[model samples]
Target: MNYFSHNPLNRFSEIRPDTAKMGELWRHEQARVLVVSNNLSLLQAEAREAAFLQQQEAVALANQAEVRVYLGSEGEVPYFALGFAGLPPALLPEAYELHDLRQVALQLPQEQSALLAYARGMVHWNLRHLYCPDCGSLTYSTAAGHVRQCSSEACNKHHFPRTDTAIIVLISEGDACLLGRQKVWQPGMYAVIAGFLEPGETLEQAVAREAEEETGVSLQSIAYHSSQPWPFPSSIMVGFQAVAVNRELQVNYDEMEDARWFTREQIVAGLQNGTLRMPPQFSISFRLIRDWFNQTGAYKLEELVSA
Candidate 1:
């Protein structure tokens, strides 16, 4: 499974509308809260695990939270997320430290990482949509932070959480796959072609378009591979495998620093000699490359990189 896709919570949408029941669950003995400040997750300083506070310990901090979200439940234990513009006064610096989710995701347990990703996405949406787009009025969180309603009696617009969809594809022709690197990325690191899905476009269309625009590699065929819930500020990545029509490269200087077709042997040599680097193992980009390389049975991508 993808890193953030292993969520076990049963998000009971039916019970969100019942304020009394939601409130009861919030105060339940098994209730736990995850805190977010400035889009960074709170982690225990020593253990590096998500800092899940008991309901009693979090009530004071929750009162000051700008976004309070009920992140569903696992059996009888309800999970919630609290977002603040800055660190709450109740937390001590020595006990907890804020870390970017992307940086620490691999270090944390899979389940905790997934839960934190869920919480981060909800908090990001709420914080960004604090005001109504329909009318210039402040909005208040309702439906357990799943919704924001305009405070204006005239507008009364209801807004839900938003997730941007992106298509990431591995474009291959014969024995090689296409990869590109942005100048801003880590030195020597390259990844698959990816772009946000434009309105009025299908996923396959987006994949083909991104490949052509970024690397000038036209696709002959495109196939769905897999998907991953990427919560680096809320986005779902749709993965695909595409066949390229030609090997000619017309690198879009504005979009990427370099783009090239890499054979399995070339990838192994690059990683071994320290001249090339792949994306983090937790990301869909790495998965796409790993799967492609492993298909040949000549080398295991994981063992090559680790060695």
Candidate 2:
């Protein structure tokens, strides 16, 4: 599974509407809160793990939070997420730090990373939707922070959490796959072609569009691979493997720094010599490349990269 895919918490959707039940869960002995501020997650500074606060410690903080969400529960233990408008309540400065979730995701345990991703998404949504778009009125959190309702009685519109959907595809032709790097990315880092899905377009169509726009490669056959929850302000990255119709390249300088077709042998040589750097292992991009690289069983992508 991708890093943030397998969330074990049972998000009790039915119970979200039960305010009394949610309050009870919030006060439960095992209830814990994950605090988020400006999209950064709270972490134990030395341990490099998620900093989950006990109920007593969180109660005062929760009262000042702009948004509080009932994340879900594990058996009897309930999990909640709190989003602060400004700086979150301070823990011991040396003991806790606010870190970008992306930077610390790999260091944390898988389940903790997934749980924090979930919290981040909810907090982001609630914070952004503090006002109703339609009614131009202030909104209030409801449905355990899964929804927002306009305060205006005349335009009481309900808003739900939303995630932007994007397609990331590895365009392959025989022994080679297409990869590209953006100028803002780290030096020597390259990954698959990806872009947001346009309104009214199918996922396959989005894949085809992104490939042509970014790398000028037309796809022959596109197949669904998998998906990963990218909660950097809430987005779901849908993965795909597509066959290139041709090897022709016309890099869009506006969208990409460079695009190229790389054979398996070239990838191995690049990794061995420190010239090529693949995406992080936790990402679907790495999975796409790994699966394609190991198709023949002659070379192990993971071993080559690690070594």
Give TM-scores for every candidate, taking all chains together and pairing residue i with residue i. 0.97, 0.96
- Candidate 2, 1-307: lDDT as tens digits: 8889878899999999999999999999899889888888888975478998989888777778888999999898999998875763453234778888887777889999999999999998998888899979999989999999999999999999999999999999988999999898888888989999999999999999999998888988999999999988889999999999889999999999999999999998899899999998888999999999999757799998889
Instruction: Report the C-alpha displacement of residue 146, candidate 1, in angstroms.
Output: 0.1
Error of 2 at 12 (Å): 0.5
Least accurate 10 contiguous residues by lDDT in model 2: 85-94
Task: Give the top-scoring candidate (TM-score).
Answer: 1
Q: lDDT at 110 for candidate 2?
A: 91
**Candidates' lDDT values, in order?**
0.90, 0.90
User: After superposing candidate 1, which stretches have Cα over 4 Å from the reference?
Assistant: none
